[model samples]
Target: MAPERYEADSDPTDLSLKILVAGGFGVGKTTLVGSVSEIRPLRTEEQLSELGESVDDTGGVDRKTTTTVAMDFGRITIRSGLSLYLFGTPGQDRFWFLWDELSQGALGAVVLADTRRLEDSFPAVDFFEHRRIPFVVAVNCFPGARGYGAGDVSRALDLDQGTPVVLCDARDRDSGKEVLIRLVEYAGRMHTARLLDTVGRP
Candidate 1:
């Protein structure tokens, strides 16, 4: 069973953490945010049209009717002093112009991966890696999707050592929230390690 929902945190928070939700098209980026957000998520999905037939590859996601055009925005309060702002980037290359602006203050990111179309997530992972952003790979387990172990995914993606890969159902509220929590914790660890490295260097 999913964890119980937390009450709304009306008190101003001591920290506002920004997290980017990035993944390939039709990989459930919006679903993850909508499932866990305390507030109604703002989505800019438009019906898939002929304009994308020549560009957007919908091989595994043919059933998807809509695609995010710009970005998805959502909010969740982790506690009294910490809140999270989720910004989901558009998957298609045409809308990638918005990513820089959305990623400006992100603490980390969650890159949703659909097992059936795993390769599609590579770009997102590369983007974060190239930018030195802390992120986790959350496999979005769709029905009938093949089960792949975390290590297998890590190997396939060529993720750096110590990076985390987790299995999740984007539709589940608790599972989605757990993904965000894992990102926060991982980022904390990385930050601490970097601090230690700096201290030890001198």
Candidate 2:
């Protein structure tokens, strides 16, 4: 299906699009959603416990005490008519079963990456790629973490040629919003390309 087109001069009625904020554990998925959301974000988080220590890796984010168990929900209005509904997926492997349900009808996704544990983001990138979902990689620049340029990060992640790789501070609202904007634009272009391909086929 051709993706929904969101334009500045869209209809006056509200046009909401679903966007998934996904990444590895403690990679700032929840932070990004909370910072950018206009309303109080709904989070399904649980305190860390001994039982989960075996499965949940806190190697890089050792200071983190909680984890998102289900998903985080939030909303942000880009303009008068265009709005984005953000869904943050759980970072751990066990909760991955819920990803399909949350990703349904999603316009696109933002895959958050932490340079300290860059490999952790591979799963999210692969998931979206295999499903043909348009996404942009937002590298969350954590304090004390090494910084990488967009080109370097793109090459390291082995991302598609046109996939955007932006360095952002997930805790900053403006930065998060910019990441969402990039995703929207990229998804729109991808949809147009697909449509043209279909028409040109026969």
Candidate 3:
């Protein structure tokens, strides 16, 4: 399917779609939102000092100082008429309660994974699964992160056969937009399937 393209002057109300970007700390969810957001992305960052050493995991992301304390909000126009609202979830384990409210009306999600700590994404993956929310897994390509194919990540996540897994550079606008398109397409397919099931069609 051709990707949707959005131009300026589109009505936000007419094409608003909410999608969640979720992952563990330092996994690039905020970067992905900023890369494609047409509006000034809203971020709530709190400095992580050595005092946080008691609670923060400074294993691979030792240099990181700030963490997303709340959700990151951004907007993207993908087609001449379509627009998407990107809601990046707080990655810290303590703020997971916010996800339940965020997921309420969301169409779908993109779970970002850093190969350096692929296991860190398990909670985000499990959150969507537990809620039966449709989502795509985007393995964010990092400079020193381990190299893994999409198929390998899919296997590691044990996702359904129909789930979409794509590689992305969250810092690149085109790459971030492509990941959003994948989530849109995945959610569209699931919506169609649900409608068919409701109509008693295979």
Candidate 4:
């Protein structure tokens, strides 16, 4: 299916969007949302327990104690009358059912990647790709994590040629904001192209 189009004459205020922050377990989805949001982020994180430990893999992120069980909600104003409502998805497999609900009316998505566990983010990339949703991969640079160039990470992920792969520090507001900006710009371009195609149709 073709990607969704944004009306060329739509109001800027009406352009407020729902953007998903999807990634694998301990990939910093929650951190990214909270870092860049202008409003206080709402999180549904719960302390990990023995029951969860049995199913949740904390191999690289063993330092992490909490998990987002449902989702993280936040808001950011990109510019005058243009805003984004971010919905950071729960990374564990059990909470994946919530993704269907969170993704409704979404404009685009950002799939965060952790180099320490590169394979963990594959599900997010695949989901957006299959859905034809505009998305960008933001590699969250953690301390002591192996360094990978954007091209190397892109190749490792088997990403489509045009997909944007950028480095980010999810814990930093500026870094996280840049990731969103990149995604918004990419999605905006795709939307504009779709609208143009529609206009040019005979």
Candidate 5:
């Protein structure tokens, strides 16, 4: 069966969109989902243990003691009738298999980035790019971390020309909402462009 299509001007009275929150370990994907979700978010976090120390890279996030082993689930109503279902993908490579399942019907994705460990976000960027999935990079402004402008991050990440890069505090509801809003807008534009291209074809 064909997948459902999400349009920019679709009926908002009863629209529900699926959005994935993905990024490197400790980049705050879980925090972003929890902050924006109107309902209590579901988490699958496990305490960091000695056995996994060698596999989990806690370089920049040394203070983080727990890791998300599965996905985080949440729901947010953007308006009276428009709601978003958020799925936060586990950041570790071992759990990557779950990503395909979580992203099956997603409208788009938010990739959280930490300036202190920017390189860790590379895999997520590559994943979305290779899948032709519309995604926005939300830089989680961690305290004491060097602040990088959106342009600088876009350049450093080598993002596609029109991909968006926004600064946000994942722990704040307003900031997290803004990131999701940006992703929705960007995804809408991308969908429209693709439709126009298809129509223009022979």
Candidate 6:
């Protein structure tokens, strides 16, 4: 038996891509980033004590104290020499300014949606849409959560026909990675389409 030639074969599509994980408050942005990230995820969490109780909502996420103040960062090596830098953005309106800095030079974004509070994702959807950045919506399936079909979410978010929406569980590494891959595929298609358009093709 000959030695396996795995080392000789390298992935042709090995390019580094930066993707932003964005959503509203209490969404699973951190969970999703941590799930697929190969490295120890770097997170900035602030203990939300009684001080924030008067301001922050205490309905679905009442038990949560610590909140992601800045961002959660992680890395995932998709293929040999190809990796992705995942930035889990803070969802609160106070941190909205950070979005511009975090999203600079990024390929696109993955907007995490929680069906229970679908409206919470409005800001994230709007932010990307306003910037004309290519993005995909990933419904994070929390435990015991009701299933909302992609179509319903698309209608709720008022996304365009070209946008891709899919279900995912931020707690599951494979599922989370699949969501990231879907966004990557969408970005690739958009890039190709733009190139074709630039060449005078309809």
Candidate 2 vs candidate 3: the lDDT winner is 2
TM-scores, in order shown?
0.89, 0.93, 0.91, 0.91, 0.92, 0.89
RMSD of each: 5.3, 2.8, 4.0, 3.3, 3.2, 6.8
- Candidate 1 vs candidate 6: the TM-score winner is 1
lDDT tens digits, residues 14-128, model 1?
Answer: 6677898999988998888899999999999998889878988788884888999999999987766777889899988788888878888678899999889888888889988
Candidate number that wins on lDDT, 1 or 6: 1
Choose 1 or 3, whichever is better by TM-score.
3
* Over 4 Å off, model 5: 1-13
Better of 1 and 4 by TM-score: 4
lDDT of 2 by residue, 1-202 (tens): 3344344345656688889999999999999999999999999989989998998898989589999999999989987788998999999989999998888878899999998998998999999999899999999999888878889889989999999999999999999999999999999888778888978855
Model 4: per-residue Cα lDDT over 94-143, one tens digit each = 88899888887777899999999999989889998887788999999998
Model number with the top TM-score: 2
CA displacement after TM-score superposition, residue 159 of candidate 5 (Å): 0.5
- Candidate 6 lDDT (Cα, 0 to 1): 0.84
lDDT, each prediction: 0.85, 0.90, 0.86, 0.87, 0.89, 0.84
* Candidate 5 lDDT score relative to the true structure: 0.89
**lDDT digits (tens) for residues 18-78 of candidate 5:** 8999999999999999999988999999999999989988888958999999899998877
Q: What is the lDDT of residue 16 in candidate 3?
A: 66
> Considering only N, C-alpha and C atoms within 3 Å, which residue pairs clash in candidate 2?
none
What candidate 1 gets wrong by more than 4 Å, as runs, is 1-13, 196-202
TM-score of 5: 0.92
Cα deviation of 130, candidate 2, in Å: 0.4
lDDT of 6 by residue, 1-202 (tens): 1111112235654567788999988888988998899999999988877888777665676367778889999988776776788889998777889999888867889999989889999889988888877899999887666788999999999998979998998899999888888888897788677778778885
